[model samples]
Target: MTSKNNPKAFPLNLPEGDAELLLDELQTRLREGRRLFAEVGQILAEIESRGVRDLYGYNSIAAFYEHVARVPRAEAQRVTGRALALNSRRARDGTTIDPVAPLTGESASTGALAEAGIDRIVTVMKRLPDHLDADERLEAEKGLVELAGVARPRDVTMAGTDLLARHDPDGKPKDDPEPKRQRSEFWLRQKRTGRWDMRGNLDPETGARLNALLVPRAYPAPGEVADDRAPAERRGDAFAEIVDLAEAGPDIPAPRQTAERVTEEPQPAQPSEEPASRPKPTQMPPQGRQSPYRGSGEGVQESAATERSRNVAHLRPPRWWARLSRPRSGNAAQPHKPLTA
Candidate 1:
């Protein structure tokens, strides 16, 4: 088309007109790029069908695109994947036929769909369960593609997600938030100062599981009176109990035994020339000797003992050490004098 007739050409010396014209040109270029991108999928499909190594001496079609065409491996792979979905083909048995992405393929080639839109439609279509018959799959693909042609990519993705959920609502992922198998992390380390610092993140379900185990144990027992422990202290006690339970359980690993140093066994010692001397047993004291201060006669202690007892017996308290040790209770009671050290 001539420059004056071409709607894409921006007119010089007209700033407002140029802005509008530039925008239109950009939009047109984008549509044209999308159309060409869709066509490239077809070419990639043909390249994939024929062994790339045999035809072009490249190990794979992706290698050919990366090395020769300068296309990134990821983009090349995406193109090949989309192409396989678009192009209808017979299986190795030649009896079963693959369903072609009719709605997506046509819309993409006609520039009705952008890259994101096409991706959304393809994702929804592929996510449909295999148990669904061909008619069901076709209907889903048609609905998604129609949405993609008009809607923004974000809206298209949301719609795709909803469609997948509707089709197989009962089906769950392989790792569907199971408490036991789900990933969780915990880190507890003792610092040099003997204080423990713990930090970790856990999935919501995992956190719930931990709360279930700890909350009940942290609270005081029924009918108990003194339950004024702080929250942190209770949690600490609960954690200690958990560790005790773990140690008591059979699953805990045995402590590692340290290796002993290797050395030659000691030789037996020879017998001494002379026999060892035996200790002599003590003889009983003379039965005739009377015990000291026993009032059995022959011991000189009765006079001094009687004199010493008479001196200190009056100083003893009524309750022995009660005056020195007993706590003062009522107003009527006398204060106890402090005892000398």
Candidate 2:
């Protein structure tokens, strides 16, 4: 069998054509290919119905297709699976069982939807809640099939997802009466090198709280240099800051104060048996001779010296009377004149 636009049928020196004509031919060929693929799926479904094991000595239709079609195992399995999903099944009694997504199957058979778009539609149909009635499932499938006709496969998938959400808003049913228990674990260890290692397996609630606290602190520091720290390092630094803040809080207790004890009492001061020696008086300079210690000033140094002598004279006991009372040794001691500067 050969196609009208088969490359093998054309000459090597075929003439070039207008760009628009070339594009039109390409689109036509692509549509023909899609139709042929749909036909292939139908044939595979018929082969499965007849019993592949008896016909080809293979355990499964996918295995038989892989060997006969010279295709990869995964690809063969995908095609066989899609074929089974889009085709109706016969019960033991020969009663017809409709395909999961009958509308989607119909669209796929006509080559109006791509295989991926058909798969998306079938998935949405299968995921619809069992509580939903047949009519609701049919309506959802119909909507997705229509969306798949005009949109790309990805857009079809999105539409199918939305359809499933609208039909089954609660998601999977919870049969158990008791709520699930949330579990969390944390471990911390200090290495010999003085660095700490921390690990945690937090439940949803605790993880959310930790994430909220760390996200703000983990942001790169604002400066000319970009922050080059790894994410784990940033989080570690943030945790250390949190510890410091907690330690400095007012709730932390103050350290205890200790008092020193005295071992013995102090003794009272006692007078010495011998009196303290008195300081000797300084000798005065001779009245006629100028003192060598004097500065350039004529009378300033003399006046200062005189003031010192006067102060010393007041301190001296009245020696003139004592001298008179004592006997005159060599000559009668002249009445001692009062000391003068």
Candidate 3:
């Protein structure tokens, strides 16, 4: 008999024959695989109920699984955790507890839902508001299971989220009041190296405000070069900019002057007991004393000397000039000759 076509074809070598038969074989094998996975969850559940530590001497079921399954600790924990959520458990008093998502567990056991779909349902059930009555919770779980059977994992997630939104509109219990205790905390410490270590926990409102302030500043500068900073680094720089803005804001008051400075008023000038000392007059450099600029350049020295001489000439004519200008005792006045250095 010819089998229906499957959009999802298995990657495997098949005998040359009807494509429909191959597709049917693929589908059958896939369903069997899912059934085997469900059986594994059941087995893990039994192992956990019996206590893996008591049976295998391992500290935890996840550790035991990691050793025997040859998987990473994280992966082992995830698998065992998922399995535990999907299977019924026994209380310390010997009472049997229902699986978190009863309908999902049943569907999974029957191979009607894949692992992904099962996880989605379990997550939704866990997040349901405590206000939901037992019957209402079961009904919600049932709806999700039905959806999981027909839809992809992502679609299942979306449906479950919508269902939760309807029940927990405010994202918390309707009957709970706002907490009185402060929920936010911050810590800052500077190391000997001058680098700062900052960490904190912020309540939802504070976190939202902080996010709004940093997001705009965290964007990479507009330029040809790509910003290679890690997201955390960019956020750090944004925080520093915020601090600077706060410090420079007009509303911030200027720092007060120190008391020492304010108290030290200029002392009033006291009447001098003795006559005020006469101001010392500047004396000319001694003759033949080299100018400080002599080694720098002749032009510098000459310019400085010429400037000094001009000042001197302005005050009174030089001796050489006066002697030259004075007529010889018996000679008539001769044309004044230019003075030479």
The candidate that achieves the highest lDDT relative to the unseen native structure? 3
Q: Of models 2 and 3, which has the larger TM-score?
A: 3
Candidate 3 local distance difference test against the native: 0.72
Could you tell me how far off, in angstroms, the CA of residue 213 lies in candidate 3 after the best superposition? 36
| Per-residue C-alpha lDDT of model 1 across residues 27-115, encoded as one tens digit per residue | 78888988887788767666666657768898766777777667789986776677777765444354434536777887788777887
Q: What is the Å distance of residue 130 in model 2 from its true position?
A: 2.2
Q: Write the per-residue lDDT of candidate 3 for residues 1-341, one digit (tens) a residue.
A: 88887566446756566799888987788778888888888898888788787788998888988999999998898888888898997765777877887777777877788778888888889989888899999898888888888889999999988997899878863577887887788887656564567789999999999999999877775556667777777777677656545533445543344554366565556478978443322344322222121134544644555454434332332233333456766666665443321
* Model 3: lowest-lDDT 10 consecutive positions: 286-295
* lDDT score of residue 219 within candidate 1: 73
Which model scores highest in TM-score? 3
- For all predicted structures, in order, the TM-scores are 0.44, 0.45, 0.47
Candidate ordering by TM-score (highest first): 3, 2, 1
Candidate 3 to truth, TM: 0.47
TM-score of candidate 2 on Cα atoms, chains taken together? 0.45
Give the runs in model 1 whose Cα sits over 4 Å from its true position. Answer: 1-20, 89-100, 172-341
